[model samples]
Target: MTTADVRTVLTDGDLTVVGQIVHASNATLVCDAQVGDTVVRCVYKPVRGERPLWDFPEGTLAGREVASYLISEALGWDVVPLTVLRDGPYGPGMVQRWIDTVDPAESAAERLDLVDLCPAGSVAQGWLPVLRARDLDGDQVVLVHADDPRLQRMAVLDVVLNNADRKGGHVLEGLDGNVYGVDHGICLHQHDKLRTVLWGWSGEPVDPVLLADLDKLLRRFDGGFAEELHEHITGAEVRALQRRIGALLEHPVMPHPRGDRRIPWPAF
Candidate 1:
């Protein structure tokens, strides 16, 4: 059966739900979930009837699945796996393997300085994010003082280039006090979908490993590997992806926004 069909069995079996569309405008079914004894989290087009799924970007879920497999193999990132199945309750939806870790919210609530997702400026190592703000549990989650001059900057440029499917909550604080990026279902897009708050290192020197990864990406793009994805992505998107790789290589020095780095509303 298609992945969509499996979600049905999951929800019907009575799983513990954790997440929901924070905005009502997004009635789409999503949950930081638990199935049987397995912790699972996923989002999908809500279905109707005894087994009806509502509207969602059809195959968008599937495409993310494809993207996850590729990046996890290349980067060893903890990309979650999802299956678009018939939600027995929510109807048609995607079922995913849940991550077992505390989120930034729980971390902050418990006064735990788990993983420092601060900006990269003058300290530490590893893939720490720069800007992390969440509205978890109706109490806005904020920990680090925004003005920490020593914190490393966020890597919004890398995120955008990756076309990451980074919902605010998908990023996690592992028990090991390290930040683990999850939910890469919508990444490595062929388009220039660079939208993130990690801009602290915008104009800084590129990390050797990150640069190496991008170079590898370019080789794959020009090779038959990218061809395998043509059926799944748009031509413009492919070009946009190439453009990002080339641009980052050429000019990896763009300053962070003068003030708030938030993308403008109604960007249409």
Candidate 2:
């Protein structure tokens, strides 16, 4: 199908469930949806299926997912896939364009290289040391490619969304060789809850290109982007989203993890 067809399907498609994403914590369904004459694979996350979170209110995850996509598009990052909130087989939910990823493990491995141990300088030649551990048997450390511009944008996106659960598996490398983020159900809260695995750019200078994109988002927020989000999140959440954009524009630096719980459990 053409790009326009895919958009039409995701926008006003008749969904037919192909299977359930059994491993998903919440109810997630794999469906083949028809737009007019074209069918495209899509993922559905119904609001009723969301498990309650003490930090986030109920029935808001699906909206947050849609909000994240809007923010990504506003920033011109294109990190999140095309997503929309609409009625589904179960009820109102979020439907996203399906991204066919390469093996998750293989993609992860391609970005990381095993080293003997943490090296001096912490910052290597365009690479940054991610983690280091020592067992009785041996010592090991993993370094990630910090220079990858795509990942840098994703990190910025996580900060803007205040993403609370950016596990490794959520960072999918599509067959087209582009990275897309998924599972934004626990994102964009009014409070500070940015948990992510893309902290490789910590303490580094934010790229100029990213800063330019952020400026665009600020303009959008001032115009209608925040208003657009009212259909999904509360007024306070929308305000918080604006505040995050302002702060990032001012600082324009990879933030150091300050929260007590910086990384989400079960990182993968």
Candidate 3:
């Protein structure tokens, strides 16, 4: 894909931003559609780290914003709109669709008001942890009480993709009793990263129901997942994902790998 060049980004108080939206765990700028029927959203990174090509193949952290979106959309998750936006403020902003995370089944679990929940959010110094602990089962996301199989599928897909931000708040439940996933800007990697309270069920074997879902996902992954990932992530990263998928299918309850890699508390 050709890099998009936009020249009119804005950061006034009136346009829904009390502050800048971001994918801080990975150093990205998040924003909503400023214009368009399609309503483009995005996360952009303008810097290329030294030996930048050695790390995550999702491209520059900013570019990962797009790669993250592509991976989620391909898996059929209801990811927020993610784009490579340009206009004002920062250089390239990763634009993501504004999603309504209000499921009647569950609360949008509170974002860890803690400063270290996300590394990028930590340095950008924009996000301040909520200053209170929250119950994931609380009605902060969607407005429902039971787990939607589809949403569960998406969550499982996230683990396979190595998403590090499956905070209770990020898994939104909708009024229609549907589950919508957001904050995928830090996803799709070759790392063993997997950390979440949702894994209370981890180490427990996959039951037949979840196993069935895996069967379906395996089929889908083999079919279109490859072509779709090729668009944004590198061949090696995509191959790693394929390997990860195989591992999950064989044993669904392994301890999440990357939980230890993240800073549990702020270095600051």
**Whose TM-score is higher: candidate 1's or candidate 3's?**
3
Greater-lDDT candidate between 1 and 3: 3
Off by over 4 Å in 2: 1-3, 103-127, 133-146
Candidate 2 yields a Cα-based lDDT of: 0.81
Please, what is the TM-score per model?
0.53, 0.87, 0.55
* lDDT of each residue in 104-133, candidate 3, tens digit only: 445336433221233222323233232233
lDDT of each: 0.45, 0.81, 0.48
* Model 1 lDDT, residue 18, Cα: 55
Please identify model 1 stretches exceeding 4 Å from their true place: 1-69, 79-94, 103-168, 176-178, 182-193, 254-268
Counted clashes in each candidate structure: 28, 0, 48
Assess candidate 1 and give its TM-score to the true structure: 0.53
> Model 1, range 1-268, lDDT digits (tens) per residue?
2434444444444544555655422244556444455434555434231121232233454444444444444443333333434443554544554335755564455342423333334334333344544443454333232222212212432453353333334445446443444444455565334444344455577666556766676777666756755544556655666777677767655445444524222111
Rank by lDDT, descending? 2, 3, 1
Q: Which 10-residue window of candidate 3 scores lowest in summed lDDT?
A: 5-14
Query: CA lDDT of 232 in candidate 2?
Result: 87
Question: lDDT tens string, model 2, 1-268?
Answer: 6666777898788999999989888999998889667888999999999999898999999999999998898777889998988899999999999999666476555344211224334555666565554444664445344556777788889998999998777877688878888999999899999987777788888888888888887888767777899988899998998898889889988899885677776666
